[model samples]
Target: MTFFTPKKLPKAPLLVVIITLMGAFAPMSIDLYLPAFLQIQEGLATTDSEVKKTLTLFLVGLCIGMMFYGPLSDKYGRRNIILIGATIYSLTSIASTFIANIEGLQALRLIQAIGAGACMVVGRAVIRDVFKGKQVAVMMSVVQVIMMIAPLLAPLVGVMLLYVFDSWRALFWALTFFGSMAFFLTFFFLPETYKKEERPKITIGDTFYNYFLILKDRRSLGAMLGCALPSGITFAYVTGSSYLYQAKYGLTEFEFSILFGLNIVGVIVSALLNIVCLRRFNVLTLIIFGLCWMSISGIVMLLIGGQSLIGFFLSTFLLMCVSGFIGNNIVSQIIELNYDRAGAAMALNSSTQFFVGAIASLLVTHHQELLVPVMGISGILAVIAYAGLYQPWREVRASIEK
Candidate 1:
């Protein structure tokens, strides 16, 4: 039997929105607390680095949770897994608001991450189950557009919560509410996409072997690495930006949020460009162009230092835009490479990206002053990714054409 393509989908718009909402949960969990990082540290009497550990723990939970959700979704169904995950996420987020110490908060954040991870992996798997080829590309673009709105609004929402409530916990409460809404929406609207007959009847050993197979595939591995390296760069920025903007630049949390919101403009433009370009250019071309943009942005950022806000903003904007291009295309390409076990493939992809992101965040948190080191490392990774992924990807495209 053939995979379900977009032309076969009945309610395309609503389905796209639901899938996008599920994907948005992960970013919302990460970005919403960013503006309050300094405040939380000060209030809880924790070191800046310790506060950053919260983010790291969240990533750890995300990676671990992704691994489990893929197999469970395959066993049960997409809608069931999503509903369970979302409910858990909402409960954990509310629990986070009641935590008094940094450690307690960190623990709850980890649980929240786990729930978000399930949503992300399951959402992608459902999309892959329902779409293929150019339709999948279009659906991926739509999902990105929907997901982008979360990061664009997160900092601003955090800032507003701070202004109104005068406490970081308010942000957690907001997250809890959002999670609750998502949970209900998933239960009510999302239907099961995966059929029992389609699932692999495999044991633990077979699951491991399947994972190994994906890792061994040159094309799949390349696409996953290409996605992960750029994501690491973004995570480095996310982990460092609180300190960089507030402590170094002397901007208030509100001002920093406003600046962060401005950066989303770049993401919006880049995503729009990706949507337009996909009609004409192959995914490999987009990936190549994105890597070039990232390398240029990293080099420019490193060369300029913290000289002017405009320079920093321009560099960061360009970098984020490149991310917009890489994020959707990379996943789209990788998902195409592993159709039979799409859930497992997507879970591994999410796990690796978050694991790499966690490491990048930890590095930046430990070495905040050394901006050059972070940017340089990211640039080097982008170069390797281009050489490893885009080159092979081009050859694959040519062979397909021939």
Candidate 2:
């Protein structure tokens, strides 16, 4: 009997759009509740620090969840695990609306994030299953562009929900709707991309072993760090941007919002440029250029040091654009290198990003003074990661010796 293949799956553009939405669960869940943090604190009689833990808990959950879902998807198939994740996500989001205390809400958010992890892990795996080489980079850029919409619109949506309902619980209701939509989309439209013949015999031991092998490989570690360290810089900005833009730079909320939105737009443009440039250059070259540019941008921002708002903004914008270039290319390389264990590779890659982000967030929250320096240092570390760990020169030398 002829078995199904991704070649017969939905058209590439449509598939890209669908999986991109699946991958957006994290940003949507995080951003949707940000505007309602004060409301949640008041409603639950909690402290600001406790409300902050919810974000930390969510990231923690993402790390734990992706670790399992990656190997699970490799064994079971992408569609099945995504369906399970969507179900948990939707039900937990609904349950969150009924939660009364801060502790209860935190627990529910953690569970909901675990469910979101399935979407993220499997979504990238699906892309790797169907696309090859530079095609992966191009599609990844498209995914980044589309996934950015969640963060761009979520805070506005959160504010609107708060205005309409006058309660922080309304934010959970919105998430419920989003989760439900993801469920229906996955159940109906998403095809099984991980072919049965390709699946490994994954048990608990097998899962850990897969992770061990990936993490132990120098190139994999390097590529994973290449993607993750820059993410730490982005999260640092996310954690500290309000303080930097409003209190330090003396910008109004209106002006800060405009600048924030413009930064995201800059990222989108950069991703689009990556797509165009993929036709002329390989993923590795672009990734190297991106890291170098990010380092320079961060250094420039540090030199500006809030001396000029325009200089700071331009430098920051350039630094953020690296997100569009480095992440997709590095991820594409990781998945390519670990094609036999794409799920495990993505799990390690994505979990490391959350872990790094959590650390960065803490650093910025405590010492807002370190934000620019952290950004500059993260870019420098990313370059070191790519050069020291990835070590493309070894391959060049071997090829010449041959």
Model number with the top TM-score: 1
What is each predicted model's overall lDDT from 0 to 1? 0.80, 0.81
Error of 1 at 147 (Å): 1.2
Model 1 regions lying over 4 Å from their true place: 1-10, 306-308, 393-401
Backbone Cα, N, C clashes tallied per candidate: 0, 0
Name model 2 segments beyond 4 Å from true. Answer: 1-8, 243-256, 305-312, 366-369, 395-402
Cα-based RMSD of the predictions, in order? Answer: 3.7, 3.3
Judge candidate 2 at residue 78 and give its lDDT.
86
Write candidate 2's Cα lDDT for 290-321 as tens digits: 98898787778778845677876777788887
Q: Which window of 10 residues has the lowest lDDT sum in candidate 1?
A: 1-10
Q: State the weakest 10-residue window (summed lDDT) of model 2.
A: 1-10
